[model samples]
Target: MPILTGDQELEQRNRLPTLMEVLGRRTLAPVDLFSFYIYMRDQQRSVDYLDFWLDVSQHMSLCRHYVRELRRSMLVETPDMEKATSKRSSALLENFGESLGEAESHPSSNEKRSSEQRLSAFLRHQHKDSSGTNQSPAHSMTSQHSNMNFSRPSHEPKPSPHSEGPTRPSFMGSDQPQTDSNSPGHTVARQDIKASAEKILYTFILPGSEREIVLPQSMLNRIIHSIEEEGRDDPEVFDDAKDYVFQAMERDAFPGFLQAKALGNLVPLSVLIRLIIGLASLMAGFWGGFFMILRSIPRHTRCWLILPFTIGCYFLVSYQYKIDVVAAYLGFSEYTFMSWARIREPFVRKLLLTRAMMASLMFVAAAVALSVLFIFVPGADF
Candidate 1:
């Protein structure tokens, strides 16, 4: 686990590695990932970013849904359009709705403080409380998650998997026909997309809304101009905002979550198991080396372990391919970056599972060869 500090600058650096690190990652079900974090983030009063992100991201799905509809209109040959879209629609939309379901409720109560205001207040308090000038947000006495004690609302239902903003529409309009419908049936047309985009602008981009987000003035102006000028319904309208919001989550919100969950220290069981398997394969390679060594010197006994393991490994590692290809192709893959968050559980699991299985086979070969070596060499205690 990384030592979180009072220094905000150092904390930022600590989070940078989250993007590249792909080793033992815990893949949370989309529901769990969003629900848990949103709840946790809510404790800090910073749930707006996630809420905004979640809402904006739904547009991407709406875009895809539109594409499938367009494809059907064109009579293109395709399969399984609704098969994958339903769960995702719920995962994305429901969460946004659930979290912001209380949109009518004003934040006048003490518990409903602004996340940025609360965070800044905490920082100011910390500055006065301690002589130390620099503090990472995670370990800062005033940071949001530190005060929550990691409690969550158990009875409350979790919303769908979304980032912080309203959902955006996608540009691609080439999806298949949905013969059978499912839950969260978000069949968006151009007008619906335009309306949703306008709502996002009003809530997040426009200045007067209660949930107004902090975006660069120029970028904000650009988005406002694009949609308002032509009354355009392009899914790409929210593209810049999406990138900005995703980065904000990566920089600010994610670390607080890691700190709150203490996920840095806890490895998911599946990932750990796969890691062991991958290492086992490496160990098996050593046995293969032993086999080569024993073969060179005329081995006296035909040990069952050495020959079998060696033969098994010969066909194992050479032609290996990603095992999760089918899952990915079928859209089990993570849709948005923020949905996966910093740990990227699903992505890492796919990598480890594929590599580990192949490595495990090779591992046995190496182990057997090593055993044979010890058996043949007298008094060679390892």
Candidate 2:
């Protein structure tokens, strides 16, 4: 493949809208349609990201099927269109004319021809349903409203029977090579493979504009070796290469530290505030209920104590779970590892963590006071 120059790239970009216009023209040939699909897929890869891989894959599959259908229909219909106008004096009239007699004389062949023609017509007009409701392609290329169906206008002048069907246009072939029927879309498939490979490389490289990572020399060497053996014939080598990448990424210690750092930095102020509010609410609810049960039940009827005890236990378990989750997210070893005495914090780490702890304790105290006022003080219904 020739390297695309800066001017060539710009020209390709500008030609996109026109190429789309050409594809939308009802005069598109099979080869033209196929080329359009290939270009569309390549363009899609450039715009689509890793998160949308599944959607892109599904769309690619649909495009392949649509192109296949277009090729089949063109093969059957274009030749039939040619034969239809053979007896006509004007070759230009041939493009639109149908040979009813030839279709009739073929016996079982008539049914087959008719069926093929009907299929072709359906493929041509499939964008519009019988009720004239416009439908998107099998996979959406854009917003449904943005995707327009291109159909030949009934009043458009057609070629005479003596004339040939429209010759395939030239502009479609600038960067695209001529496609042969037996090729089975090698270019687009190869493009997808390359896109996937690049994505894999990026996954290991780690994407961040702020800094370039210096991976371990051993790991880097392993990655290079893996790339070398990517498509080797030996199954063991391929598996080993895959394993090497997996192991490099999966190495627990380094990633664990990086994750610790990321978790520390990424935890938002709102999340810490929310955690404090939640814990405070829990403590208030639990303690208030505990004291209430204690006052209401008789000392003789000790079984009533279990209700408040159960409530306290439930609160404790739930709060512990919540704390563990938050602590993990905030880069603490565990909930119990909150204080510097238990677990050391980096120089500036306490700024956020300390605030979170203070807020939590205040909430806890407020909840306890509220519970005391409600349970012990008389006429405190509100």
Number of the predicted model whose lDDT against the real structure is largest: 1
User: CA lDDT of 332 in candidate 1?
Assistant: 40
Deviation in Å, model 1, residue 7 alpha carbon: 37
* Per-residue lDDT of candidate 1, residues 1-382 (tens digit): 3433324323343222251121101124322344334443443445555556655555544444543343343233323564244344323333333333232143223332232223223323333433534222111223221110112234333343433432322211212222121213323343444455676788678987757888999898888887787444445666678778778767766665443232221123323444455456546645644654555533344354465445334323322321222232333432232232232344334443454455555656555665565446543132
Model 2 scores a C-alpha lDDT of 0.33
Worst 10 residues of 2 by lDDT: 43-52
Q: Which residue runs of candidate 1 sit more than 4 Å off their true CA positions?
A: 1-26, 29-32, 76-186, 263-382
| Each model's lDDT | 0.42, 0.33
Q: How close is candidate 2 to the true structure, as a TM-score?
A: 0.23
Model 1, global lDDT: 0.42
The worst-scoring run of ten residues by lDDT in candidate 1 lies at 143-152
Quote the RMSD, in angstroms, for model 1: 22.0
Clashes per model (N, Cα, C within 3 A)? 45, 16
TM-score of 1: 0.36
lDDT of 2 by residue, 280-366 (tens): 655655565555555563333433333443334333432433333235325443211222112223322343354346545554555
